[model samples]
Target chain A: MIKKSLGIALFTACFLFALCVGPALSADSVKIGILGPFSGSLAFNASEMKKGMLLALEEVNDAGGLFGRQVELVYGDTECKPDKGVGAVKKLLTRDEVLVVGGGYCSSVNIAASQIADMEKCPVVVAIAISPTITNRGLEYVFRTSPNSPMFLNGINQWLEKVKQAKTVAFFMENSDYGRDGEKIWSELSKKIKAKELAHLYFEIGDTDFTTQISKLKNLNPDVTFNIASTTEAALIQKQAKELNFVTQWIGVGGQFTEAYFKMTGPISQYAMGSSLEPTLNMKSPETAAFVEAYRTAYPDSRPGIFSSQGYDNLKVILDAVQRAGEPTGDLQQDREKIKDALEKTDMKLTQGRITFEDDGQVHSVVPSVVQVQLENCEPELRIIYPEDRATADYQAPQPWRERECQ
Target chain B: MDSLFLQQVVNGLIIGSVYSLIAIGLTMIFGVMRISNFAHGDYAMVGAYVAVFVMMWLPGPLGWVNALLAAAVIVAVAGVVSELLIFRPLLDRRTDIDMIMVSIGLFILLENLAQFFFEARPRMLADPFGGNTVDLGLVSTSQLRLFCLAFSCVAIAGLQVFLNRSKTGIAIRATSQNSRAARLMGIDINRIYTLTFGLGSAMAGIGGVLYGTLFAVYPTMGAIPTLKAFVVTILGGMGNIRGAIFGGFILGVAETLGGSYLAMEYKNAIGFVIIILVLLIRPQGLFGQREGV
Candidate 1:
């Protein structure tokens, strides 16, 4: 009876081992790491990012993957936290032993994770973290395909210079790396334009109440408010500002150029303009049109936004580099170095813009546009309103909240 | 500047009332059961999601009433089930720390479950009162906020009456005061516990719906309110209903006013600062009676 039981246990153990480990061992794929806030406050962004990444990976595999090996993705959930991001990058670089890592959503998380990649000597192609310090720090392995904070305001600067020229400006910023960098750059822009800098108010990242800050801003009552926040906080700020009947030409970073922002705020979102690297609705190039069509086919119910394009570009850049790097020489470090070298010399036209890295590892070819949320056929749609070539609609100077025609 | 100060005050009071509503629910659960239910805020998260689901079936202004009602009912039932499945089993064999740990585990589980079922995308509850503002002489506020304030007041007053005047309320108070004595007096301790949890959870649900209306709702939306609720409960004296109400208003006003006058970044820290001062000055809380008394 004991021998029979032992034999049964041995068979079950073998079955479990094969079930868990056999596939991993048998799969001859080049492992690449992708990091994002997979399961936290910013989990929605991660899902959108993943869809874009999967689309890219799918296309690559269909076209016969790099060096005849299928590309496998190892996802590390940063949860939008810096420490968590570092841990994820560490695990991806050390344990997963991925050839290269890509995709970072939060600037703070990306900044921390990039250091870990640099230390590990693995190339990390950042998809969408905009803090200038990310590339400005001069990290060799850290490369950002997305425009940095300094470049983000280029289109907005044009808008502010010509139309909707405001004399006074105030900042409603979150107290994070992203917010600080935005404040620094926009504050400089405000000074450059000879616009008087009014009260600059800051709030914590996850704070639900902005009434106090709004009240402070209302007292100063600047002509324009440069607000820096992610989707949730950004929506709340707008809603609260409207509740207080405080009206201003609210300009946001690329964070507001998402479908979720429009859906969350509804009609109140109308007239809010944001500077975006990729205006999803206003497809400027054939490359962008193709990518958007592919995205729509994959995600039938959803529209691809800024992060989606960034996610696609992140993977595509890595794949391009890998293709140039030639066959993996079996040494992990050597293969990683080869990819890093190729990544430095990358210059390709992507959906967002032409991707070309400067000496600082920052993308130099991104063309930004300012898009406004307008109610088109009773649906909130983002229409490009700046950089005249891409302007789908003229910039409409908004009426006060109480005066606006909203159903 | 004067109008701004008044606006800040009005905003504080309105927001404070919400704090009171959520804190009262948390205090009730603690008072009767001696369980520091860390999962209390997640009930509000559930309530918010429930309101979202119900609003889909019933849209428009009047639909908000139905949505709020649906949230309260569903979340109350969730509270009861949680009590039976988790707390009731641990009631006899566990320490306070164990109960707290379990509640925290339950909190994380509920949050993740919500995330799994409803993606982490922030959802808005349709405005019950179409975006309209009621103009006060000194300051103007939204009709929705005023409605939230009124609702919070009415709900709190009703709870006060239920506790002071109703038969079940008396039994609940008795159980809270001394569960063993109440049991000896032929009170069903188990029933009172279930009722308290349900009542507290219902208040949390209502608070959630109102809060969701004010701010967007998502999976982790409950964390801030839960932390604030804890601060209010502590400030009001844990398990003290009247104290929770007053504490909520004080904390709310204090935070807003402080945020206005002081640095905005330290606004949330105001709650913790109040906690420290309260702990140092009056450990029993503002209205908490002595242990033996």
Candidate 2:
């Protein structure tokens, strides 16, 4: 009886192992790794990033192939958590044997994953995570295609200093590296506008309630509330703020400009301004317009937003670097080094803007846009409100809940 | 400052009522089934999804009422099905670890399924109240929130009456006290257990609709609420109905007040700390009885 049971256990163990380690990946394809929260709360954004990368990939493969070998992607779902980010990166580097990695969506996830990629000598071209610490560590392999935290709010800063001129500010930041970095940068920028800091509150990533913090803000009633949250959290915070009768001009720094935000909040999102790497409605360049057209054609149900643009640019930059670096030598270390060197020397005009990384791996040439949700033909629309040259609409002052005509 | 204090108190009680509603469901499941159902919170997620689905067909004030009823009934049916298909087989098993592992597996499965069907995007129920606020001097809140609080109170009261006055409620109570003795005494314990599971899930579903009304609903919305429910269950004493209610309210008020007066960062931590102190000081829980006494 004991021997039979032991034999059954051994069979079950072998079956499980076979299930886990599926068919081996062919060695012919050039593998690139992608890290994002593909399954958790941020899955929609991650899917957008993935779609962008896939669009870029489709263009290259359609033209023929990259260096006579088809480029394939290996995805690592970080679920926007730091510990999972570490594990996913380790798996991609060691198990998948990817040449280069791209598409780090969340700042905290990117920060954790970048460390492992650097340690493993794999080049990571970050797509959207804006925390400066990812590149400030001076890691040899870490590079950012998107602007850092300070550079991300250029348009917003210009608007605050020139147009709005707010005096008092409050902060509702998510409790993470992203939020902490946002608080630091915004606090410093607040000094330029001479806005007194009224309150700074932190909420966790998955938090759905904000009444406790919003009530406190109601008492203080700052001129503007600078919020640092993803798409969903931003919607909830603004809705709850409205619900509690705490009205203010809400400024979302670098995260809340999305299709989901508009859908979730509707008219409650009116007058709420946010900073975006690329304007959602207005296409900056012919290249951007073409990319957007191609994206809409590919994904019929969904529209490409800032995240898709980031993903598309990141992949394009990587593929461009790979082309410049010539054919792979089959030597992983030497090829990775070649890609890193080629990336450092990159100077190209893509959809968003010119992609050029400084010594710190931060993009210097790209200028972000400030956008506000406004009433256009009885519907709330995101309009470019800053950088007078690119202004689609003038910046509107804060409107009280009852005074609003749009809803 | 006085108004702020009053505002915080009102917020705490309002949110506390939600905690009580969810914890009652958790306590009922534990009290009768003796299963540590980690997926109890997913019932709320399911409820929210159902309500959102119903509201699409039925819009306006009448739509919300229909949405709440549909969510409760649909989630209750789902609970019965889950108990029959999943938990019923495990009922004969002796080890406690299997039930825990299975419940956790259920939690992951349900979350993934919701994500697959509904997508991970956060959605809001169309507020029929149209952003109307109820102002009383300095304290103000949305009319929708007040409605949710009132609904929660009514539901809890109704459950209390059913458990005390109804025939099936007596059988459930009997089974909870001594399952083997109740079974010997001609009570169909399996049917009673299934009914109890359905009732508990219905309560969680109602909480879900109210919660989804106040906040955004998505695939993983139930995760935090479930964690809070567990904390409330332990604080009120495991398997104690009255204890869960008081425990939920205390936790909600303490967390809100602590977040307001102290640091917002420690809002969740305060509940855990209180639970720790409770464990060390009173292992049987604040309102729970010593076993076999």
Candidate 3:
């Protein structure tokens, strides 16, 4: 009877081990969380980010997945709200239990989500949030895949000095965190460039009319106008400026140089210049060409915009991190650390260019391209005219005022 | 400073004209119904969208005109439908606050619906006048600005004539003064309320079209103008028509001039301060009548 009882106990123990270790010993699955504003005012940009991410995921999966395990994406829609973003991060971490999280479009949303990541010790890869405060907070776990505001503003300043030859400047900005931060940077840079700020107009988020502001601009007659607003506001301001016949040189930040702006303002967009991290259709790079072809094939309805390219690049960075980390073990903490370490040491050549992260987890190598609107045969075109080596189109300098030329 | 001051004033006037049209509609609705239509701004947004669609379909001369007509018709129909479905039912229950709340709900609903359809991108309504600058020697002006000012004046005159000569207009005025008395005198209270709302919405729609032509149209385009309209209506006496026009111009000019001379960033704050001062000084408006009839 003792022998029989001992044999039964051994069988029971073996049965339990098989039940626990069966799935673990099989192929592993790596889950990555994507968070962004998918159902709010910035939904279009978010949607672009999603498209880019999905395309990269498809490419990665086709190439035998990340570290020979299936890479899965879990999406959380923050709707461009801070509270919603915080909630989304919590859900992705606790419920989804994703190893790596990515995608934040707005600066405020990124800040809130980054705080959550810091607390949970989960590494977050920001796709396109450019607020300087994101990095200034000194969060260890937060890594931005896109360039921060300072780098972008510094590029703008350099372009203004070397290309536009701008001296007197006026600033028009929206009164939000994004706008205020950008305004501060631009203001400081303006002084550095020896440009006098004639007027700095701050508008609310939903303001439609700018006649008053434009008229004030006309009166000041600044040599150049810096529109530090979103693409929508920039379009409206440009249209109104055209109406007032205020023919001054115009420059805008990242959000301002897009197909939507060109379509809205048309010919009036001429002589307007802006900077972007991604290349447009005019770049004609082999990597960009391949992306455009794949994007067109995948998303027939949507045009491959600059933001989409940035989003796709972000996904590639994440996949590279996962592969470099080696095969995912069932252990969550161990896998997360490996991925984070891999990201910190990323020096991969990507479609955008060679991407490497600094000590603060910010992308070190970023090429900010300056583009200007030109009237090519009565049609407005966005021509990359700065950084002559990378430019695909010719530069047309702004026609100087009669007095300035005479002087 | 002189040239800058002059330029700012000119800018203010152009902006002021737009405020006048929006404020007039809000003032009319409040004066007649004694209910603040919070959804009035959404009506403006709808108008802008309608105008944009029209311009896209019919691009050329008279595009602006077609857009104006389309905005008026669409907003009028929407106003009538709201009265029939939402406002009239609430009125029967004697729930004024509920109606106000309903208007707010409608505002959010319409804005979201607009997002679903328009996709948050700002669309430009073709400007017939284009961007021709009329150099007025000292202060420059756009032909579009001149057109906007002229349009506002004509609209005000036409509305005045309709209120004075038209039979339905007199009934609306009578209803605003005394709803029960008008009911007793055989005036259909429901009809008057519907007509007032429809007219007010039509005015708001026209304002949206004009504003879109001058600026650009987006889902949240109506919010700032809507808030300004509320301030203008309250400052001009809740139900005063002429007072709304005057208040709109005053607020617009003040904001423009303040931004130019004082601080460009504080332009909105300047308008808010004016409202507070007016409320403190004369509880009524600059042109508001005393409550005693």
Give the Cα error of residue A274 in candidate 1, in Å.
Answer: 1.7
Candidate that scores best on DockQ: 2
CA lDDT, candidate 1, residue A24: 59
Recovered share of real interface contacts in candidate 2: 0.78
Q: How many residue pairs clash in each candidate at the backbone level? A: 0, 0, 0
Docking class of 3: acceptable
Using lDDT, rank the candidates from best to worst. Answer: 1, 2, 3
Which 10 residues in a row give candidate 3 chain A its minimum summed lDDT? A398-407
True contacts kept of each: 0.72, 0.78, 0.51
Q: Candidate 2 docking: what grade?
A: medium
What's the candidate order when arranged by decreasing DockQ? 2, 1, 3
Docking class of 1: acceptable
TM-score of 1: 0.94
Q: Is candidate 2 or candidate 3 better by lDDT?
A: 2
DockQ, candidate no. 2: 0.54
Over A1-407, each residue of candidate 1 has an lDDT whose tens digit, in order, gives: 56446545754764684476323532568889999998777888788788889999999999888788988888898988999999999988988888999999898999899998998899999998899888888899999988887778878987898887689999988888999989988888788889999888888867888999998898898999999998888888888888887888889887756768778887888788888765366475888988999999989998888888889988999999988999888799999999999999998988887898988889988877788888876577777887888788998876876677773
lDDT of 3 by residue, A48-83 (tens): 788888899899889887666778888888877789
Q: List candidate 3 stretches off by more than 4 Å.
A: A1-41, A57-99, A161-165, A281-284, A299-302, A319-338, A400-407, B94-96
What are the models' TM-scores? 0.94, 0.95, 0.87
Clashing residue pairs, candidate 1?
A: none
